[model samples]
Structure formats: structure tokens, C-alpha cells
Target chain A: MSAVVSLSNVHKSFGAVQVLRGVSFEVGPGEVVAVIGASGSGKSTALRCINALETVDSGEITVCGHKVHDPALDRRALRRDVGIVFQSYNLFPHLTVAQNIMLAPTCVKDMGKAEARKLAESVLARVGLSEKADNYPEQLSGGQQQRVAIARSLAMQPKLMLFDEVTSALDPQLTGEVLRVMEDLARGGMSMILVTHEMAFARKVASKVIFMHQGKVWETGPGAMLDDPQTQELREFLHNGL
Target chain B: MSYQFDFSALLPYWPVFLQGVWLTLKLSALATVFGFVVGTLCAIARADGPPWLKTVVAIYVETIRNTPLLVQIFLVYFGFASLGLKVTANTAAVAALVVNVGAYTCEIVRAGLESIHKSQLEAAECLGLTRTQTYWHVIVRPAIERVYPALTSQYVLLMLASSITSQISAEELTAVANRIQSDTFRSFETYIVTGALYIVLSFVVRAAFTLFGLVIFPRRRKLGTAI
Candidate 1:
């Protein structure tokens, strides 16, 4: 199959500040591509563009065969084929974990209540939170809430999953728990792309690593590229931990 | 010390006072229900309707909110009379109260609706919820839940303001009190009784609203306090 996602010479701006400038990359099926960069390096904006959350200025972005930059695109159809988990968890606080997981399935896919609950239960088990189905988002710990958010997206059965700094808000210990769930998903052969700052985690799990700096893709290679970065910027970024 | 108090003179008018209380309660109830409906609909339109529709709702809200409720009541009651409509005082009273309260309710509810964070709407969209689905589930219900107390207070104020309808001889509590005072010639005692009844009615409306909040938002108790 063609690349699951492709962006070529993409350009985006917020007023005078251009966030993404001439960015280009592609993700193959079942491949875990980790994008590592400093804050405000346009990594998050690129992920949002994939989900059609941000309209592009000029470029080509195709995700799951939907033209991301097209004005006539059916966003709901595109969203159905791709799922995204945000840094803040963003679970509906008013809803129980099971209801949050079942929301998309029942409302969008027209799944029956019993079937949706069964689906919710099964996904919750995958994330190791089956017992917390009835708990509200605010009642759970930060890591647990992030895991439930992943399960909410998983219930949609999207072909591609995007994670935008999902561990940014958690402490080191909590980050480990969320990472474990993600590693398991990667092992299960789910096509994924994640924007993350954890260099060790990216090297361990990402099949391909993309380094972005100053709104440009600075380097691209397999996970081993971190050990032998050809670009001086990547080496300096790794050394400074920025 | 110039005049003597005579509570005894108003004793036989208790039945008339009860009738006034009953009519006032009925009028208050009808206005509350319809006013809430009208206000919420207007709020939704102002928040998310098309530009022209939003403009229309804005004009209605500002027009009513800027004018005195008494003048609006007169416009509904006497204005309809001049038009050869001849609407009963009761009908005009409810209509006037509804139109007046609806504007205030619209402003209150619109504030609630705007308080919802933009990120919540983004999450709902990512979940593939249609526009209508997002509005009801993610925006309206949660917004209203967040602002339930504000709405309860607004409706209670509307109930008190219903007393103004008595000017048009709607036969509500104050109007009934007027007839009793005239018959018994005891204005002080009659007004004293009416004021106490108004206080009781306020408490009753508040308690009723608290119970209603409990019903529509059963999950609120589980997640947090009554708010």
C-alpha cells in the first residue's frame, strides 16, 4: 500500500510566525515514526494538520488516502480513519471511562449499546484499565487518564493513530505507565506517529525517527540515527536536551 | 400613633387572598417554563446560528433587556387591546413575562454556552460527532449543567417580577391584595400579609429549583457537588 501519511513541502503560519516551512515526510503501514524536536519546532502543528485540525497554507498532505489540504474533504470521514490522543488527556470529565470510550462508536458508527460497552470493556482491558470503566476522568490519576484516552481512541478502530506529546503532562513514573501501553500498541503492529521529547523511548520503539528544528525537518533515518546524527543541529539538540 | 391597627377587619378576606396566591403561582409557573425554553433557544442561536440569525437574536435580547418590564407588559396588554385583539389579562401577563424573562434568560444562557472551552469542541469533532451531536452533547448540556444555579436564580427573579403584571389587573396576588385592602379598609395589614406570602413563595421556588437540578443532572452528584 501507499504511505499511510504523506506531507510534501508543507507550509503553515500563525500571523507572521511560520510554524511549518517546507516540511516533508511519509509514514508506511504498521511503522512507528517518532518525531523529536524542541518546543515550538512545528512538530505538534504537523500532527494537527494530519487530523485536519489546522488548515494548511500551502502544501500537500494526504492521510489514509484523504487529501488533508483539500477544502472539499469530508473531515468526519477522515477522522474516522485516523485517531489522535492529545497531551492533556481531554477525556469528557462528565462521562465515565466506558461512556467516553463508547461515545464515538455509538454516536458515529451507530454501534448498539451492548456491543459498544463490550468494545469499551475490551479496549479498557488492552490498556489495563478494565476495572475503571465506571470512573470519571478527574477521579483517575494523570497516567491512568492518558491510558483511558488512548483506549477511547482505540475503540474507534482507526487505521492510523497519532500521539502528540501524550506524556508531556505526566511525571517520570506516570510517563512510564503511559509509555508501556503505547509500546504494547506498537508491538501489536498498529501504524502510529508520535511527537515526543523522550529520546530514549523514541530510539527504543520508533522504526523511523524524524528530527525537526526551527520549523524544518533537520534529519531523517532509522532509530540508530540518534547515535550517529549527521547534522550538527541534531547533535547539539541531543547534547543540550532542548 | 395617629391610626389604630385592625388585623380583625381583614380576617374574612383569607379566602380571597388564597385565590390570588393560587393565580400568582399558576402564572409564575407558566412563565418560568416558556421563558426558559425561549431563552435557551435564543442563546443557542446567538452562540452558533448563522450571522444574520445571530444578529436577529441579538437585537431581540438587547431590545427586551434594555426596556423596563412594566413598559413591555403594557405593550403586550394595552397594545393588544388597541389592535382589537382583546386578549385576557392572564394571557397578556404570561406573554409579557415570557418575552421579558426570555431576553434575560438568553443573556444568562449565552454566557454559559460561551464558557465552554474550545478544546472540548475540538475533542468532540475528533471523535467524529456531527455538528448537531457536538452541540447537544458537548456544548449545550454541559454548559447548562455548569450554569444551572444562575438559571434557577434568574427564574426566581422572574417570579417576583410577575408581581408587576398585577398593574394590568391580572388578578394575581398583589391585585387580590388590592381588592381585600379596599374592602376591609386596612392597607397596612393587607400589605403586611402580602409581603410575608411573597417571602414564602420565594423559598418554595428556590427549593423546587434545587430539586429540579438534582433530577436533570443526576451525574453531577457523583462527579462533584450540586454545582
Candidate 2:
């Protein structure tokens, strides 16, 4: 029940524009926190900052005991504890599904091929793509490819996983398959923080829901927050399909 | 007056021509292998290394790419002799070729590297892969695979350009042909045979690269899709 990720007064800017302006939130162990907002509301930027994909210009942020805001942070160690899935699925196109899943374990962890292959098999099964062990990324559907990407991240055995609008690129049917896999992960007690536009999935699956607007957390409560919003930004964001 | 064509006059020196063909193959093969390695490394350095290293690689790439291959061979051949390096003409030729092709390869591979989206590197980093590991597994290998066709074409062109090395007394295919023509006074026939050999050599080189591409990029072959 302890916090696995915590961000207090986080600020990040890209050149002239400030993407995240004093954003703050936290997620406890086995908690699914969904960040929903408009495109430029800094939801994705906040999520990226958790993995140190974007450095914080100010404020304190910690994930899995790593001080992400610190300049000399051991990023590699921090990354080892965090797995992030992108909207693009980012699978190594040259590698088969098993190879893509096995890549980090074998190369980073120095796991033997046999052991890595077994781990890949288990994770692929977890994503319900056990039959796609030998298929290339281009050979699979978008949903199936996204599932493989999830399995690829899962193969690293990360302490926390981040999903950045993973289903944003998929059709509704394809999105359902990917969402189902994520729902299973949530049900299995995986610590997850996702930036998503899927209000239904966020309301149904996220234990905590954060509504961001203009680079700050405008409203935060349980999944029921979507039903009754205190802030105008949250109400409008929920009313309009983003 | 109708001129009679006589390739028979040059048939006696088939073994000599074959030797030249073999040497040309060796020169091209050695250059391609070494150049690919050097060029891929340079591309990586140029794309992601430290600012100073990137600047150094940039200078190397621009210098080599802007100059002519013939000039590079002449410089390498004469420069080594001037410095008392004592390298043979073949060694000079290969060295020049490796240097020349390395630059072009660097540019081609760098283009491939640039085409990779930022999300891929972020994913690699989030998976806890080290910089070296990421470059090798995620960046360089896939970049090379994507640009394999361009690299292969550049190498084949380098093979054809090996003819230019004849000026430095490399004794490769063209030099051997020149010698045969001078000795037999059958200039047209000798050159016609040499031209045929060069064509055959080019096909052989292309086949070799195709076979290599199939082996190295198994996904490209198996999936029959763009990597």
C-alpha cells in the first residue's frame, strides 16, 4: 500500500515552452493511475518525466526509490525498475516477436538464450500472443504488435510499467484487445501509470484517476471522479472525447 | 573495309586475366568488409557520440566524400611512399578503397540511423539497455539492415572503381588487361574480353552481397517485408 511513484511540484520546459507547470501526483503499489487530458495538457510529458525520458527543470520526483530529479541519478538503474510502452509499439522490426521480447533480458541482464527464450515465452503468453513467437512485427496486427510490445517490456520484469496512450493508434476493436491485456495486468496487481484518452478504460480500471489541464493536476480522486468533477476543466475533458 | 573481330587472339592469356579478376575480387571484398565496419562505427559516432567525437567524424566523412576516389588512391599510394611506409601497390589500393568507401558508407548508414524514430531509443533506454548495448542492438544493426541495399550498391560501385587503381600499378583486372593488350596488339579484342570479365565480376559481387544480406537480415528474408 506504500507509494511506488511520487512527484511533487514537478516542472519541465522544452526550450521556450513549458510543458509541465508544477504538476504533482503519486501512485501507490499495485495502483493503476490514469492521466487523462487534452493533447497539450502535459499528461504525456508528466508520464515521460517518471521514466526520466524528460528531465525536470525543477521540483522533486521519485520512482521506485530513484531520485529522478537529481542530475546525477543512475538512469540505467532507474530504467531497470521501469518499463514504458509507447503509442507507436516501437518493436525492433528486424527481430521476431520472441527476439524482441528476449532482447533486454539477454543483452542487458546477460541472461542465456535458453533462459531468455523461456522468459519471452511466458511474457508472450501473458499478453495472449503465445503463437506469435516467431512472427516479425510487420507480420502482426496493430493490436497484436502492441501486445508484443507490452510483453517485451514485461520481459524485463520491471517494478513499475508506464503506458503512454498505447491504444491511441488502434481501431476500436484493436484497442479492445490491447485494453484487455492491460486490464489483465491491472487485475494481476501490476503497478501501472498510463496516459490515456480512453475514458471508459480509465474509469473502469484505474484505481486513481488524475485529470490534468494546462500542465497541472486539475482534479484527482478515485475512478468515480469521472462521474462527478469539481473542476470545469475535468468536466469538459470528460464530456468531450479526447 | 569490314574489320574482323578476333577474341581468339587473347584466349592464350585467360589464366592471366583470371588472376587479375581474382585480385580485383580480393581488393573489393577486403575493402567492403573493412569499409563497412569503419563506416558503421563512424556513423554511430556521428549520430550519437559526444560532441567532439561527432565533429571529428563529420570532418572525416566530409573530407573523404568530397574528394574523388582516384585522388584518394593517388594520395594514399604516393603519401605512403613519401612517408616511407613501404606498403605494396595492392595494399595501397585496398587502404584507399577502404577509406573511400568508409565515407560513403558512413553517410548512407547515418541516413538510416537518422530515420529511426526517437521512440525506439526511448523504449530501449526504458528497458535498461546500456548506451553501447542500445547502439549495437537497437541502432547500428537495424540501421545497417535498412540501408543494406544502398551499402551493397556502393560496394559494387567500389568494385567497378577498382579499375581506377590500375593507374597506381595495382595489377588488378584493368592493369592486367592493359598489359595483355599492349603485348598482343589486339587492343579491341583484349578490352572486349576484359569488359566481359568485369561484367561477370560485378554479377558475382552482387550475388555475394545478396547471399550475405539474406543471412544477416533473416527477418528481411523470412518476413519478406521492410525492416
Candidate 3:
């Protein structure tokens, strides 16, 4: 099967600082890829560049066969196919959970309100948040809000999902709940790229693990790489935590 | 030779004063509605439009805010007459009030729009919402909510400033008070009563806006807290 996402020689810089330098990776269909790195190691920027949220100064990013770096690519169309879950659950505070889920389908796809509502309800139920449909983001716990954010993306039926340290903002208990939902998504054949510090979850769910250090990929291999990293930086990173 | 306070002298003209108050409410209500519409549109342009549009809005806001409202009223009332527009004083007063308050509202609303988190816009994009949907759902609605208190305060100030229209003999509470004081020779007492009426009117406007906010942001009420 072909890769769902491909990043070739991706380079990005913000003013004088370079974030991602000559970074490259591929994620196959229905595969979960985990990116482990220290803060400011360019992992999150790499993920953001895949969706064109951050423009790459140079290089190619292809998601679901669409070239994201090309200015001619229909950005809204590209974004619809690749959903992103932020560290902070950024649900529309003014809208109910159901409304938040229904917004994209109805607005961008021109789906009818009733149809959108039905799809939203089913997706919310899939995330086990059916009862909180009418609740606002602030009314829910952090875990529930993150699940709702995941469901909001799922409502779009995206081809690929990018989790940018989604649980980093949550408490330990809330993080566990969110991770469980992510595991459920992975089991259901949803392709995902997760930038996370949860070594155990990365090991269990990731089909491939990548270690990024100093704006480049330092190591790439199966889940076992987390245990026996080849690079000194990766080994030191794993040892320091242990 | 002792001066006695006589409120009874004003009793006969109570009906006329009430009519003036009624007109004042009508004028302020119209100006506030029109001003809010203009202000909201200007704010959207300022926040999201191209640099040229933003610059134009900036100039309009600064010009209105820096100048005295009294001069603006005269500019609209007398300046328009000089230009041969021939509009009535009351119409000119309302027009001036709308233009003046619209600028201040634009600034307040723009700040609220700027306060929206960039993450919210990204979330809207990931949801595949159209540009218009993103604006209405993510930007405009919440921006308005965050600035509702400021908007109401400005509207109340606008109502109080309706007194300035009396300079051109446009019939309002202050104008009535001016005529009553001159006729009854009780300048101090007449202004005191009119000032009290204005205080009461400001309270009424604030209560109305509070109710309106409750209706518009039902989620805030249901959630039992603000985000």
C-alpha cells in the first residue's frame, strides 16, 4: 500500500531561527507513526507543515496524494483530508459539542443541517461523548474536551490525523483517557502521526517510531527502537527519563 | 427675600418634558442600532481585510475618537447646512451621534476580535469550515460576547450625550429642561431633575443590554461559566 503522507527534505524557518531542517518521513495507510523529541526539536513544526499550517520554506509535503506545499492546492480541501488535534482542545467555545462537529460538513461540504447533525451525533457516540452533545467545551472535563476535539475531526472523515502532543496539556488521569480514545482510533484503522512523550503508548500503538533531535530525524525504526536506540542522542534521551 | 424651592411651577409643563424624554429614547435607540451595525462591519474589515481597508478604518476611528463630540455635532448640523444639504437639526443630530459612536465601537470590537486565540482559527480550519463560517462561528460571535460590556457602556454614554443635540434646538430632555428653567427662573432645580432622569435612563439601557446578552449567548448561561 502507498504512503498516506510523504515529507521529502522539508525545511522551515521562522525569522532567524530554523525549526525543521532537511526532515523527512512517510506514514503508510492506517499506520500510526510516533515522533519523539525534546522541546523545540522541530517535531511539532514538522507535523504542522504536513497540513500547511506552517508554510515550509522549501521541500515537498504530500498528504493523500495532494501536494500541500503547492500554492495552487485547494487548502481547504487538503485540510479536510488531514485533521489536526492541538495540544489545547480548541473547540469553538460559543458552539455546543454537536454544533462544533457539524460545522465543517455543513459549511464546507454544503451538507444539510439534519444530515450533518446525524453524522455529528454518530461520531460523538463513537468517541463516547453522545450525552455531552449539547454541552459547551468549558462545561466538559479536559479529557472529554479532547475527545470532543477528536470527534470533531472524525466528523470530517479525514484520511489522516495529526496529534500534536494532544495529551501534553492534560492532567495524568485526563491524559490516560485521551490516550485510550487514540488507541481505539488506531485499532479502527485510522491513520495517525502522534508527537508524544508517552513512551509506553508510542511503543504499543506506533507501527514505526521516529526520534527527532536538533531539527533532523536522528533515528527511525520499529517500536523496539524505543528500547535500543542507535543514535547517542536517542539513547541519552531514553536513558535520562529511565 | 428668601428663595423657596418650588417644584409646583414645573408641574404644568410635565407633559411637554415627558414628550421630550420620549423623543430622546427614540433618537438614542435608532442611533445605537445603526451605530452597532456600522461598528461591527468596520471591525470585521479592520481585523481581516487587506491592509488598505485596515488603514482606512484606522483613520476613521482615530479621527472620530480624538475630536470633541460637540464639534462633530456642529459639523454635521451646521456644516451640512452650509453645504446646502438642508437636513433638519434632529436628523443631523442622530446622524452625527451614529457616526461618532460607530468609531468608538469599532475600536472596542476590534480589540475583542484580536483577543481570539490563533488556535481557534486553526481548529476551525481543520473542521473544514468555509471562510464565512469560520468568521461567524470562531471570530465574530465570541468577539462580540467578550466586548458586550464595553459596547453597552458606550451606548449609555451615547444616550447621555444626546443632551448635546439640544444646542441645535433638537427636542430632547435637556432641551426641555433649558426651556423650563428659563421660563420658571429655576435653572439649578430644573437641571437637577433632568440629570436624575438621565441617570434613570442609563440604568434602563444597561438592563436592556444585559437581557439581550443573556439571549444571544445562551451557551454561556447553560455552561454556567465563561470560557
**Top-TM-score structure, candidate number:** 2
DockQ of 1: 0.77
lDDT tens per residue, model 1, B1-227: 68898888988888888898889889999998999899999999999889999999999998998899999999999889999997899999999999998998888889989998888888889989999998888888888888889988988888888899989999799999988888888999999999998988899999998887877875776765765
DockQ of 3: 0.77
Q: Of the native A-B interface contacts, what share survives in model 1?
A: 0.76
What lDDT tens digits, residue by residue, belong to model 2 across residues A73-185?
Answer: 99999988999999999999888999999989998899999999999999998989899999989989999999999999899888899999999999999999999999999
The TM-score values for the models, in the order shown, are 0.95, 0.96, 0.95
Q: iRMS for model 1?
A: 0.8
| Residues A25-131 of candidate 1: C-alpha lDDT, one tens digit per residue | 99999999999988899999999999999999999999999999999999999999999999988888777899999989999999999999999999999999999
Candidates, DockQ? 0.77, 0.87, 0.77
User: What are the RMSD figures for all models against the true structure?
Assistant: 1.8, 1.7, 2.0
Give candidate 1 misplaced runs (Cα > 4 Å).
B2-5, B8-11
**Poorly placed runs, candidate 3 (over 4 Å):** B183-189, B223-227
Model 2 lDDT at residue A66: 94
What CAPRI grade goes to candidate 1? medium
Give residue B51's error in model 1 in angstroms: 2.7
Residue A22 Cα positional deviation in candidate 3, in Å, after optimal superposition: 1.9
Clashing pairs in 2: none
Model 1 Cα shift for residue A178 (angstroms): 1.0
Model 2 docking category: high
